[model samples]
Target: MELKGIHHVSAITANAAGNFEFYTKTLGMRLIKKTVNQDDVSVYHLFYGDDIGTPGTELTFFELPRAARTHEGNNSISEISLRTASDAALEYWKKRFQEENVEHGEIEIRYNRKALPFRDFEGQRLVLISEENENGESGTPWKKSPVPAEFSILGLGPVYLTVPDLEPTHKVLTDLLGFRREGSYLSKNYGQSEIVVYASGKGGPGTEIHLEERKDLQRERLGRGGVHHVAFRTADQAELQEWIKKIENTNFINSGLVDRYYFKSLYFREPNGILFELATDGPGFTADEDLSQLGESLALPPFLEQRRSEIEGKLKPLETKVKEQ
Candidate 1:
């Protein structure tokens, strides 16, 4: 079965306060969930997205205070491209970045679309792609966002990956994941590397995954200021089960059927060592809190509910609300 699109792209950010300011005030995404990492209760897990934190619109960050820096290399998610409506929207973001003093690159073309690439304070590369024609994926905008409704970001677009060897991971994307190869383009920023673009679902930013082969570079280190994993969307549990068997026959391995409170998940590492997850989108953020109060307080899964006081004591409080500019 064909997957719908991206579930979420999770990453690590060293500076929690800086990330809060940048993602909320500057970028204008809603802080949909404020919780601690399930595996590590001491660390904060912050989720940012469109008004309601839709699956494709999500980008999550695990805060690691004083953690070692990671070296960017192969088998890493180098860039997270988000979707905006039009050329004017992309242009509006360029001016907004400059006004906010966020460092950004010049506008560039990729696969006949205009893109504005920029990096967060912690050096996570990001791009805002123009998806004016793909209106179906355009999400509801935050009314209070510094960015206007028409110009706000839609959702996750191209999750650019750097792989040491393309063949191994390419199979996982195509044969197992059901993404068809779209075409290729040479990206000047990544050592003039030829980027292969694969797509699934209907044509839009969220459906595209871009790969840049970098066999010469070393395996990337997992640390602060780097992508943690890429989660692809599965329509339901039945689809997730079918994928487990498909992955079992291949050289790759997966952690099967993890009940992750909001949604079920299956974690697998592609041949190149990048973590990829197939997640079912259901019982979403609204499961715990009303939509209006999302991210307003620390939300724990049923298992962690009793340890709320202890967990709260260990982690620093995240400033979820932003005063509109």
Candidate 2:
């Protein structure tokens, strides 16, 4: 049994309203779920993806109001990558970012794939990579997105991790998690450091992890715009249980079998202290809301339904009305 590609990446956002506007309006990703953070009922946990919130396509953010900016450094999930359909799409986004005044870099080749690095309003580091010759799961684009379907963000690409030492992290990824070392590339930012490539299920942009060993920087002070965790995809609850057993068998302590309501999960920190989650792909966002009206209103899991009134009272209203093109 092996993990699928990336399940989702959950990051932190300071302003829910601005996050909503940027992701849904500027980036053209559909806000698939409008919900509260289950652990802390007061804050919002917003989910964005393709037309429907597909497993690999999901990008979530936990709103931490008035949080400090991320102190960028090593031992962190450095950058998140979004997949587009082609090199032509890269050109489209380049022009689009210029027109929208979005902070971005010129299109460049990353591990042989054309990539355009950009930042969100929160200074969240994200790169758009062309999936021209890439394989694995390609997420469906929202038909109604302001960005044309041909050039819209498809799904997650390789997640980049910055660590001081790669040995322990490499062991955890290879021996524990079954990711194989594919190859390496010279670091774009740090010329002295080499970025290693590891692929899990089916080797491709979606299934890969680009690890950079950066001993030069301090440990990241995670805050707003920082990635909380990156979850790799598993098949279902049964498969997730097997993974839990495997994780428990190892020396690493883990959050065993967390029932996330939408999908079951197992959370554990790798050797470098970066949070890694193993999550199921089924019982998705559709479990609570209809496909047509997802993210249109506040959604509560069945377990949290009784506290809806209390939850709603705590959250500051951020309009999530569905606007079709």
Best by lDDT: 2
lDDT values, one for every candidate: 0.85, 0.92
Displacement of the residue 13 alpha carbon in candidate 2, Å: 0.2
lDDT of 2 by residue, 1-325 (tens): 9998899999999999999999988989999999999899999999999998888999999999978999999899999999999999999999999999999999998899899999999899999999898766788888778889999998899999999998999999999999999999886667757899999897789888999888789999999999999999999989889999899998888999888898999999998999999999989999988999889899999999999999999999999986656
TM-score of each: 0.96, 0.99
Q: Model 1, range 1-325, lDDT digits (tens) per residue?
A: 7788888999998877788888888898888888888889998888888998788888999988977877888888988988888999988999888987888999989888899989888778888999866645767797678778999877889899898889987988898788989999998876788999998887567988899898788888877878999998888888888878887887776787888888889998878888999888787899999998888788999999999999989977666765546
RMSD per model, one decimal: 1.5, 0.8
Model 1 TM-score on a 0 to 1 scale: 0.96
Backbone clashes per model, in order? 0, 0
Consecutive 10-residue window with the lowest summed lDDT within model 1: 316-325
